[model samples]
Target: MLDESLLDDPEALARADRRELLRGAAEAGARVRTAVRHATEAGIAELKPDGRPRAVLIAGPGLAATGVAELLGTLAGASCPTTRLTPTGVAPASGALRWELPGWAGPVDLLLIATPDGSEPGLELLVEQAYRRGCSVVAVAPAGTPIVESVQGTHGLFVPMATAPYEPTEPLAASAPGVLWALLTPLLVLLDRTGLVSAPPEALEKVADRLDSVAERCGPAIAPYSNPAKTLAAELAEALPVIWTEGTSAGPAGRRFTAALAELAGRPALTAELPEALAAHSVLLAGALAAGADPDDFFRDRVEEAQALHARVVLLRDRPAGGLTAAPAARELALSHDTAISELEPEEGGELETLAELIAVTDFAAVYLALASRA
Candidate 1:
């Protein structure tokens, strides 16, 4: 059970969050709002073109890279291909993209490097490589860091994120799902200027509005009975989560959601695209069901041991559109196997709003799960 009483008890909830994860999560909506101001002041309004860039590359370490890749990918959508580069192992000097550039048929026209803390050996090396290759670069990091200095007069642009009251001094990984908004807003604004993505003038307003709305709905002040995030956390407790999304628009958000589940809740989650997941996940679900309880066991044992093998399927979708969502089939499949299922779809809006809704909700759920586990 979720301990509904705890959701309304500030003292109990605070005790559950040893790392103040809830604090970071709660400020996410405000963080995005703050990011908009930073992005505008950074002068990303003026971007020098690289003459129809062949491809866009976003490289960073940890959540920074993932956020950029996913957010940029969603914004850029089909306009231009995007790739995210990450370090595999710890050979700082080797860099993550050092050996991977050869496969591209042509040079990367644009490369954005983000290191929330402003320093990552691998990311620095990647920045050097982009400079050497003459790619137009935009490096987002802290002010006065090596990354900001290294990109100083080169063909690169530096967008620095100053530490704000909304952002804790802790590492970006600990502040993620919240930090992502600031890290990604500038790139979205730049992409909008580049004519690659269509971000209307009210777009940021819509995003902020959605973020604020979700925050209100899922905030600590809300009771579990009325809070969607808390309810979802309760449903996911003591069960493995298999997450799949309806379309590519929500793909990056889904990936980020899973990452939050892992980081905040200390739970591993599996995520995949639709059509593919339907076939691949069926086998795993079948085996899990087969190994455990009978499908028709209405009076099965309620022993703790019996629940250990349980799993839940979470499907994320956009609420406005209704073309070919995977929820129906996926839900049916899970129910057939006697597995629990839950679905989350953000309120109707453009791609970004949908992304914000799903992410904000899942982000809160992850924090609540972390809090509930400790309680």
Candidate 2:
């Protein structure tokens, strides 16, 4: 019989899994760093700006671009001016940084391309232009995209874009500001600490303090026994085989959840949407449910829709009638019919109990082991 008691202490299970996942992530990051170091040493020398250029942010229709622009503006301090780039007109400036688009005369000190998925063709062109212009190019791609390869080939610098995970009411547009700020604030502080950018010590300290607070409050829930991050990662890894068959949102959530888990486990989480990372997991999970071997298939099928709604769906084996998990079969059917998926939980009742149950059955050890599998 399946040991149900393991589901009783989800946190403990997650913690045990997270340790391994975190270590694996660290190793992966180190490899990436080595590649970056080699690229920086051999390909393109660092661009040293004679003076700060008037930064111009090309406002694309994408939410992530707008968010990055706003973040840069805030962190660069009041001296830097930001102008919107449109199809019709260009802002009057001698030296300016254009984000994503490279339509400007004269020299650009820094060119940054920010995209949610890092799949923009325009970004490729912009990097080429930056190479031609001898300007510093920073491409902010979704984590795990071939950004490193692209940048390395282009002989440009690649900075992994980072964002905080927050459950907002709407799409990224609604919560971009806060998330961007959270990411940029820490980055700016780190830059200042390393002396890459000049800022007063007190000012830097304030930013660091704020970042610490944000990490404590909004960061992933972490513990030795049941780290939310590790548990999420393991869940994603196990579900990887059928991730794509699941809804896009669910896929991203799984990715993001796994990334978050990796970070909490003391590794560098990918700086892209969660769905991307968990794409494989979602497909596998969906396929597994389709196969119908697991008893939790009914609730598992609805995970994506529930995540999209930002509502937690718990599958309770024994509960009152007409509750959230009351009709698992119906929930699965409804989820199958829908286009989006949200967080799904298959278990008995009570919030704590549900969390425990999900954790108990999942192979936290396997998830941790997968992290080690990364080269």
TM-score of each: 0.87, 0.35
Q: How many residue pairs clash in each candidate?
A: 0, 40
Task: List candidate 2 stretches off by more than 4 Å.
Answer: 1-48, 54-61, 75-78, 84-103, 162-208, 214-375
The TM-score of predicted model 2 comes to: 0.35
lDDT of 1 by residue, 1-375 (tens): 445567678688987766666776666667666666667777776556545567888777676567778778777878898888755774433233332343452354788776676655556666677767777778777788777777775657777663456444444453355567767777777778777787654787788888888888888888888899998898888777888888656677778878888876678888877867889888778775432455534555776435554668888876423576667888878888777888887777888888888888888888888777763
lDDT for each residue of candidate 2 in 7-74, tens digit (9 for 90 to 100) = 33445434544333322322222222332333344322343445655553433324334544544453
lDDT over C-alpha atoms for residue 215 of model 1: 81
Q: Sum up the clashes in candidate 2.
A: 40
Q: Which ten residues in a row have the lowest lDDT in candidate 1?
A: 93-102
Provide the RMSD of all predictions against the true structure, rounded to 1 decimal. 3.3, 15.8
